[model samples]
Target: MALHPTLQAVTERIVARSQPSRAAYLAHLDAARVQGVQRTALSCTNLAHGFAAFPANDKLKLREQKKPSIAIISSYNDMLSAHQPFERFPQIIKDAVRQVDAVAQFAGGVPAMCDGVT
Candidate 1:
């Protein structure tokens, strides 16, 4: 089925805008892909540096690469009504992860854009 004209135009525009970065990102992922345990590819010192700031117990768990590691990323801008609710999600998610014996870290925030707000 054909897309509506407006939808097709918007999709084309978005694809064009994202092409370069998306291609590069895909290439990077292809280059980084490996078999078996990925984290073990890092040197001991490098791995230590990655988890140095973690709590002592977490540090040990991460070093063993046994328990799952979770990165809790959110787009939680307080100014955006749609995103404001996400501010509380990291803690909630971490709490849930802990119940499953996984490690969750608030990795970072990304931009939350609302066209209506803009």
Candidate 2:
């Protein structure tokens, strides 16, 4: 499993931005690695679920892999999928951003939306 250059840049960008405390990042990463699975892992109900990615070592390798199939970043920050395959990539990244928004609300990082899903 060799890493591609594009993926390497992505991994680096995540690290640079998230700037997690080493221990917390490791813990969260472990949790995500154990709890997380591949993006294409299909289940009937999973299509509606939001993904949580924690920056840890095991997952980090996959995050660095060539062609980079999935995203591995802090669960709280919104992911960028501004321009992608007009189909699934947009949805997947939007889902991740929504998940972060939901969690950030509970943590009081951002104000809760009374109107919802703006």
Candidate 3:
């Protein structure tokens, strides 16, 4: 079997359009990679400051990096219907991650704007 002509053309166009961005993103990731555990690269004081707000159990889980930690960054705001559903996502994510023996924190929220309303 083969892809339809229209589908193949659309796929080619998307690949061409994304090529530059994909290359730049790969380069950025390579630049960010470094030897050893990335989190341990931070100074103890800095690491403590980062972990200060976490609960005791989470602090212990994170200290040894025994369990994977997930940061749930969201763009949730009640003002936008699209963003509103994200409000419940963190707890849902946390519960799911916990079941997998991983930890998830609602790290932070970013500003969300609905251009149509704005």
Candidate 4:
């Protein structure tokens, strides 16, 4: 994804502050990816009901879906969330986990296992 001009400028400034070493810059980018996981998980909750009435064929179709990019991006998101880092509380993680789990179960998919792009 192309960074917005403002975000790009901000990233440049932050990276410049931690100068010479690129670790800070990479960390910043990874942090953004983690946030994307949380955001997608939340947004996906809204799409959960769509699966409630899925037939067996629909379940098969869902099973064929590739793993969601967010799963990888957020692989650590859940851990971080559990620790309440990045301002995410445990309850937030709990709720998100439950919602995600329900959606997963409904689709006959394993929690955080499917790529979600059928």
Count of clashing pairs, candidate 2: 1
**RMSD score of candidate 3 (Å):** 4.4
> What range of 10 consecutive residues in model 3 has the weakest lDDT sum?
30-39
lDDT of 4 by residue, 19-68 (tens): 85678778888897665433234345554554445455544444444322
- Per-residue alpha-carbon lDDT of candidate 2 for residues 1-118, written as tens digits (9 for 90 to 100): 8789999999999887777676687998798767654545655355223222432432344333321233323223233343233334444663564454321112112322332433
Which has the better TM-score: candidate 2, or candidate 3? 3
Worst 10 residues of 4 by lDDT: 67-76
> Which pairs of residues have clashing backbones in candidate 4?
66-115, 67-114, 67-115, 68-115
For residues 19-111, write the lDDT of model 3, one tens digit per residue. 999999998767755332366878999889877877787788788766777889977777777666667888899899988976788888777
**What does candidate 4 score in Cα RMSD to the true structure?**
15.4
Please, what is the TM-score per model? 0.56, 0.20, 0.61, 0.19
Question: What is the alpha-carbon lDDT for the whole of candidate 1?
Answer: 0.77
Please give the lDDT score for candidate 3.
Answer: 0.79
TM-score of 2: 0.20
User: Which pairs, if any, clash in model 1?
Assistant: none
- Give me the runs in candidate 3 sitting further than 4 Å from their true place: 1-37, 115-118
Q: What ranges in model 2 sit over 4 Å off?
A: 1-20, 38-69, 72-118
lDDT of 2: 0.44
Q: Could you give the candidate ranking by lDDT, starting with the highest?
A: 3, 1, 4, 2
Q: Which is better, 2 or 3, measured by lDDT?
A: 3
